[model samples]
Target: MISLLFGAGASFGAELHKPVPPLGNYLFDKLVELGGAFAELPDDIKQEFRLHGFEKGMLSIPNDSRVINPLQKEIAKYLSSFKPSNENAYVRLFRSLREYAKHVNVITLNYDLLIEHAMLMSGAQKVSYGIDANEKSYSVLKVHGSANFVPVLAPNIIFEGNVSIGCGAFIETNQIRSLNSHEEIIKWCDSRQNSDLSPIMCMYNKEKRVVINPKYLESKRKDYTGVISNTRTLIIVGVKYIEHDNHIWDVILDSAPELIIVDPYPSEEFLLLLKQRNITHTLIRDSFYKSVLKLSLHIRSRVKIDPQI
Candidate 1:
């Protein structure tokens, strides 16, 4: 079966005019709102948010600082609060795809609830989020965790192992910044270990804590690997090929599936990289929503001819 993998850009067309903020802007605004010192912050840091890509902005966060760590937490909080409306163009596209596919699985790296909202609006009677033993209809796997998901809390900092810093404060690793506190929680989410860490968490409840555990990492790894092993065709939307996310490239390399990449302005380096890897990919120099619409027509025409055989 074919799998649809979505990047943040896939939903950008719909969110262009909406109140939803990008990662860089979201983080920067939250930091300033939380009474952090943004006045002395470097110009480069502000510019980082304006970058055309997601990874560049996300990775710009400092690794071992309390400021960035807390900022990560705030970012997760912001995403959770982002309520998606059904009026967006991408939402309509999602509805159309669901109606056509009927039983196909969708895997998305975006943290937004655009896909989920679309599914609900489309009247898909049966829908599953992750690995479901009894699910038979369509499913959506948010590889990077979604803003709507509430993660399970763990006791005594499970994954990071209780380590204290010289300042007498506990130090959390970057992985903690990526996953929740409980390993089992992430396992339940079916997030891939090698997948880019999505910052989605439930921070509204004052009593709820975050857990990032081994099971979570393993689950994420398993989901990604399973998709790579099983999928025959992969449609990548709104994702730019960045060096930091080479793990995705690795999956593409190993899977050797027919790839269709949809982007408005693709880089020459990305095209060169695909050629270098000997991976076959069709670059659509158009909006993802438009490309998907065109692809859907072709897919339907092809499906119509199957019964004649």
Candidate 2:
């Protein structure tokens, strides 16, 4: 068994005409709309926004906690409303990948619906969440709470309620408002002190804050453990390996499977880091879609299965 992991960059091929709005822009626009002022901004605010892909002068106010909180909520709402255009390149890529990995598992950090859509398009008979012990077909694990999964709230506890086409499992309306609440949002600014159960909200500037359900985190870890221990090869695509996602890297390194990395241009630093971790079986490719297709064909040709009577 082999598993595949995908990141936001993989969604880029989905052919969204408007680049998914970077976190910084989403935060900035909302802050200005809410009357958040520059003078009230935190000293490190400008630098933070820049990391998420915001230029300093791009927005009117200084990007700081005071301004960013509400902006994040607005951004979440905006993201909730985003519908993929009909002609999506990512859709085709996802379909191709799904067909290629007929017997494998896929884990993605992306919150978008492209992968799900692709699976549906491919006429896949089954898709499992990695939670079931007996599932045997293709599966997808959205590590980060997806945009199409809604959470059910019960006092201090939250659980996955339903999976809708456009809703996410981790981000509740109340959660978004809580994150936007200037007073409550401060609790998450220090990543170390934050609860791991909370869904992690990331700004384009690379700053990450946890805002997930603890239960979900446990489920994710358990599922990951099962997949990693069983899978023989791991393919990583479109992930930028940001510092916030160090935990994922740790898991991959610990798994020590045959590793393959696919990206248009992989950085030397990333390669060095992988090397330092002693992940020797790495393959870099120019096109993730193409690589996955080729790999699948090769695997299918090599494996032989008996037809049951």
Which lDDT values do the candidates have, in the order given?
0.53, 0.51
lDDT of 2 by residue, 28-107 (tens): 55444545343345546645554544534324333333344344443344444333444554445445444345556778
Best prediction by TM-score: 1
Give each model's clash number.
12, 20
* TM-score to native of every candidate shown: 0.66, 0.61
- RMSD for all candidates, in order, please: 8.5, 9.7
Model 2: lDDT of residue 33: 51
